[model samples]
Target: MPSSRSAPVARVSQETCNPAVCAPIAEDDKRALVDAVETFIFDCDGVIWKGDSLIEGVPETIAMLRDMGKRLIFVTNNSTKSRAGYLKKFLDLGLEITADEVFSSSFAAAAYLDSIDFPRDKKVYVVGETGILGASSSSHWPPYDRELDGVGIQHLGGESDGDKKVTLASGQLMEHDPDVAAVIVGFDRNVNYYKIQYATLCIRENPGCKFIATNMDAVTHLTDAQEWAGNGSMVGAIKGSTKREPFVVGKPAPFMLDYIANKFGIKKNQICMVGDRLDTDIMFGIDGGLRTLLVLSGVTSETELQSESNSIHPDHYTSKLADLLTVKK
Candidate 1:
């Protein structure tokens, strides 16, 4: 794998403010930053919908952008939902989107491993749900003859898991597959002492192996509740135990941005990241050299914007996506 030590940190600022925001920006800046951007990456949950409900005006805004010949992709740090699941939700909500147009942290993680020429046929130990690692084929794991042959672990239960039988399956997987090459964690609801203990031991014994996560989001919302933990929490526990940091590949990561850039044949400067969370959405824009717009409707509240961290800052702020049409173009 490539040295992630050189990956640019995620931060946000007004580096790409529209020329209209000040004295006329140079034509090149406008062309590079605005006119050339034919693609827009939107963060799900906060930007488009909260849970299953669509934020007001999102559909119209998306439709307008689509009609204008702008390419759109929903980029999410949430790995709890698979591409098919996301596509189904979007369709259920009357939004026009396809699985191919959506990219998740899971996808980026796999791509990152692939970019560095990681062997394609190696076995991997996955500690998350199927959504994060249950693909027919993945770039993260070396290509092997077996499909899902490697040990699979689920750390926690989902919204319906409480009513189901099993919980804390990840610990069991660890017990079953101690010799796996890599360990991965995504979103789990049954995270407990056993899973953490097992994961810690695995990493401690295998320092040379890889540790990957689907995202860093700290919380997720269900129809009736908002009890969740971000992947960072897991990272923290492992780091605290092993004194080692794992490689993260998700939203705001250059790999995902690079993937989008290559997929659409668009320049990084021309892309706009529209998201509600400053850390993932806005920070991605800053680090990727793209435009950032913070929405008032998501996880990051206006009050949190007063903090000193540049990760929470955005190039532009708005209460809703509809406001973009009114941007002084």
Candidate 2:
């Protein structure tokens, strides 16, 4: 419950709170908007920087908010990076943030397994990057582990499984390990027939094997302003072959929201979620009962926000996260 503001959240929040639809934050409301919340949870890719290029004034704005004694948390659906990996990126971007402040879908995947009391003796077949394995645990990954901590789930597959091939030579059938109790799917740039086929076998053949997805984001950004296939596309392949849906653990799931809220002891009404995507980012905030701000700097466009068919609406709309730079002590 950290705050520099004297009062609580305003009676009027986002456009969704009003009888009418969403509206842009006026020049005068900038200070009021920032003052209303105790914590700010941000979505990384689209809202912070698209690919390598940093959004103008983001670092300054982040520093400004920190100076005001506000709590800041960065959350992302990209499973390619871990908490340690994201911390390095934030520091490189000139933002004074720590790994404890950043949570990614990769971490979420591990967290989800812990929440459900996943058997320590069992193994998770990962179909994403090393981030899901975390740092201390990454090098130790094998097809299965005899023992593991709750957060450090025993996992394999990931980059290790990316290049492995399966050959059904001379009437032989593909085989899979029964210890693989769960298949965690994230964004794997090297997703090949081998990984998909292996994942399908684990989920479909292995009894009680769980299917988990980091996030079902339709598309993601890897390069400057360019969109590429998201983890959802990789997930879809397994879904098609296994005929099973995955338990998602990223944005729009609200698992991370609950984590930070309880850990910080902040109420949902005392927080505001800012992001560029309506589906995952905005929807995530909405589901968790936090105020939502939609920024037009990433996957979402102004046209998409104003689209007549769109049902998801954030509490406020802004050009970018840097817009809050207008607010001061």
Candidate 3:
């Protein structure tokens, strides 16, 4: 297995903007910026909306861009919802978006599997919700019990009590199934000891089993609060247990851009990624060779951009996506 440390980091051009100082999107530059890009990739959560409410002026701005014949793509690192689920939110927010226009880390994960020709006969042991596997709600493991820590079904070749039995929620003693050929980790709100244990076992016990994660977002920006336990938190646990890293298929990794470019036949230089987060959204654009625009309406703040420790930067920054409204094509 390849070492995670050896994984290649995406390279940007030497002219890439300095991480410590981002240029403000001046009024004069807005028009040029708009004209230079053929497609706009938006980060949904903090840029277009916060929590359940749509961000102010997003609807009009999107419509205006669409009327201008510019392609629009919504890409999000949040794997909690599937693409179909996300489309419902867009419509509910009064945005006229189709299923193809929306892309989430969940869809990227599936696309990655398809690209690699993942075997149809093998099942994936998902440590997440329906977003990752598109399984029915009932197919998910029951709400995990905290008290079940360290209690796990034995792996193949592992010694167990002579009874060769493991008790389940239904009070039935069963043996472990070894059919799982991959372990997919994503955002699971009901995450507990069992899910982690099972995922770890699948990767460690199953030979040549793939390890995939939707995204490694450390925090999710929510209305009134920031949730620190994102999918990265869950993936970290599995990594620590198995000492094997997952092939993260979301932003900053290039899989999402690869999918969009292949499907739409859009050139990377003609795309602009607009989002609030520096790590996922902005970095994704930079990594993919697309122009990047940072908006202050989301996770990243102007103050944070000035920090010397900040390593990723967008080509331009604005107070909000509404700023684009001032730019005429």
Candidate 4:
């Protein structure tokens, strides 16, 4: 069995520290940063709207960017919604965005599976409700069917037996399915023992079963409140049970970047990623070799940036995305 010990922490060098890794985009350089970028990739939750409310000045700023002919792409680690669903949300929030302009971890996961020619006959056991079913569906690849396709697992918060093991209502041990060739995990609001148990079983019992995840985000910001358990929490449970790491297809993985670049035919250097979180958004930009801009509107703060010890640093820091409008060319 693989040791359950946590991975060793890497020491940060002075040159690799976040501050030394990238300099803040000074007022003088703000204009250049703004002028040089031909495309802007925005993170949805924090950078644009929080919860159901749209952030102030965001609509106008986006409009201005559109007027300037800058290609705007909304990339979110959020997997709860498909691209079509995201378009509905954008429209509901009074933002003018097309379906093609939106991309989510759900879409990325589906695209990845399709790229590798995932076995159409094999079923994917979904542990969450991130629109993965719809995103991965086609005429040949149909949506999840509990009997024909695969099962949707969710935690019902039931009591464990004497040995602290999960049992079905009938007091039977959870059985693994051989047909479940892949386990797809995402943000499952109803995550429970059953979900984790089946996911673990499919991966462990089934031969060559694939473990995949939309994103590894530990927490997500909603309105002014922070949601403690994100998709990462769910993925962690399966990893702990099976000692298996999932193939993450979201930000900081560069898979989305590759998808965007190939689909839009844009150069990496010509794009800039703007978001609030240092780990997902900022590190995503850095890993993709794109200019990164950190905003204080969402999860990360100036204090956090100053104290960050890792090599994940943004090329610029702004009070908000609206501040970019004030930058003069």
Candidate 5:
């Protein structure tokens, strides 16, 4: 077993960004900043769109970046959707994004299991939506887009327990399947005590069972105008019960960062990560040794980015991703 602190990119992580240099990009230097990287990695929820609505200028800005021949990757902590589901979302918002361009935590969780050579006979217990099971309403996904299923790992207890309840009877006996080999906790709108208890049981009772979190984002933009409790809240329940932290596979973990770099055959320094949140998104880029840009259109605000107590800082701050195009030729 490896420590969660053993992230491969620890060289620059011990140091925080100097606030003096973390200032907004000057109008004259924006183009230079843009030109510094050949690849642009984006956080999907806040930086690209909010729930069902596309953020202002997102489509045009993405098109502009594409025209410049920049490699674009959309990394999302939201596990409620598979890569196929996210592609439908982009199309619904008129973004014209391909499925390959999107990388999601659900996929990361599966990727992690594959990396570890998880046994083909063992099964995973998922605490999330149908997306975690690779089962969604999108016509393109179904069995074909099933990530965990595709990897030869079967799963149980996702949306199936949405309507289930655990009545506190005088002698109610609860039981977990002995065959469950790992517990995967992701963002579930229908998360309940039943799901929490079930996941806790698997981690504590099952031998050598691994606890995995798709991500631990504190807040999520589930709707266009409000914040909802992120998957971190759900993972916290199991962690508190089992007294064990999960190996997160989402942003801030660099699992996807390393995956992206290897898949694209590019260098870490050649990539610039643009995201809104300080903890998950920005921290991910900072720890991965890639340039970071924080946008105000998401979870993080300008004050938070420049706070005295705040240690994490991005290379540049902007009101939105569209600001990258503000550079004058």
Candidate 6:
């Protein structure tokens, strides 16, 4: 197990006793430190930027890593944006990276299903709006012409724009074809009771059918430091009603870990799980048996670390990736 530490060294508690305590890495020393890392996995959104603004020293840190010969990947749980969209965002942020270097929860979900030999030419009902649905279809998941029955009826919550209406239903799915293969859950602003009822029926009828999810992020970040309901909430609704656990394929899941490792032809033990969240990023390492690095640039904090009642801990802790510059010999 990797030891853990609080940012200022004063916040150490039973919660911080997992692995190793990492010393702070300064902005100027990021290169020499990360050069020792074969690969670097970065959490976007809070760590890189919040909304449109880039975090201070991030761009330079990325450049320094590139110069140091470390492979980098943008590991994001945000399924709202497309790969091209995120790639463009990276370029716009002056990172000079490609879409190949980035992985989204949406991508992981789609890729996971594709990796499996799911029967072709069957409809996989999607309980999501555009982003999740669109990403799932990126591999040309075809023969899917209609939405699940009652989907349109149930996807009507929160505020609605005229264009964001559900047009499918569960009854319609059963009407068209009774052999639905899977149910993919994602962010659908227009979800409703009918959609839920129908999804439950589909899962119940076909016990072998898959239930895949893009992510379980409980809160989606808003422009004003606010949080709105996310897919985790939606998944909970179905789980509560149906008593079935949907397979998560994002973040801390081994999907991305395996994907990156295979891409780089490295072992899981050789890579470090670096991110801002303890449950997701750090746990990814703990669950997968890899080292973990928890950064304070995102969701989890020192206060949260000290108060954590669980044994979950990271191998190392730092204020940010840039702080790796202070790693001592």
Backbone clash tally for model 1? 10
By TM-score: ranked, best first? 5, 2, 3, 4, 6, 1
| Root-mean-square deviation (CA) per prediction | 7.8, 4.6, 9.0, 8.7, 4.9, 7.3
- Cα distance off (Å), candidate 3, residue 167: 7.5
Superposition TM-score, candidate 2 onto the true structure:
0.89
Which candidate achieves the best lDDT against the true structure? 5
User: Model 1 segments beyond 4 Å from truth?
Assistant: 1-36, 135-179, 222-227, 306-311, 325-329
Please identify model 6 stretches exceeding 4 Å from their true place.
Answer: 2-35, 135-176, 308-310, 325-329
Tens-digit per-residue lDDT, 136-227, candidate 4: 34223233211112233222111221123464577667766678787878887777777788888999999998898889988876335657
lDDT by residue (tens digit), candidate 1, 127-225:
555555544353222321111322232222222222333254555533434454556666665555555565666677754667777666666654425
lDDT of 6 by residue, 72-134 (tens): 888887766556557767778787886678777756666666668555555566666544444
lDDT of 2: 0.79
What lDDT would candidate 4 get against the real structure?
A: 0.73
Which 10 consecutive residues of model 4 have the lowest summed lDDT?
1-10
Q: Per-residue CA lDDT of candidate 3, range 85-140, in tens?
A: 77778888899988779888877777777778777666667676655545324322
Candidate 5, 180-256: lDDT as tens digits:
99999999988999998998888999989999999987788888778888898999889899999899999899899
Write down the lDDT that model 6 would get. Answer: 0.63
Cα-based lDDT at residue 6, candidate 6 = 20
| lDDT of model 4 at position 197 | 83
Candidate with better TM-score, 1 vs 6: 6
How many pairs of residues collide in each model?
10, 1, 0, 1, 0, 24
Instruction: Give lDDT for model 1.
Output: 0.62
Candidate 4 runs further than 4 Å off: 1-27, 135-171, 308-311
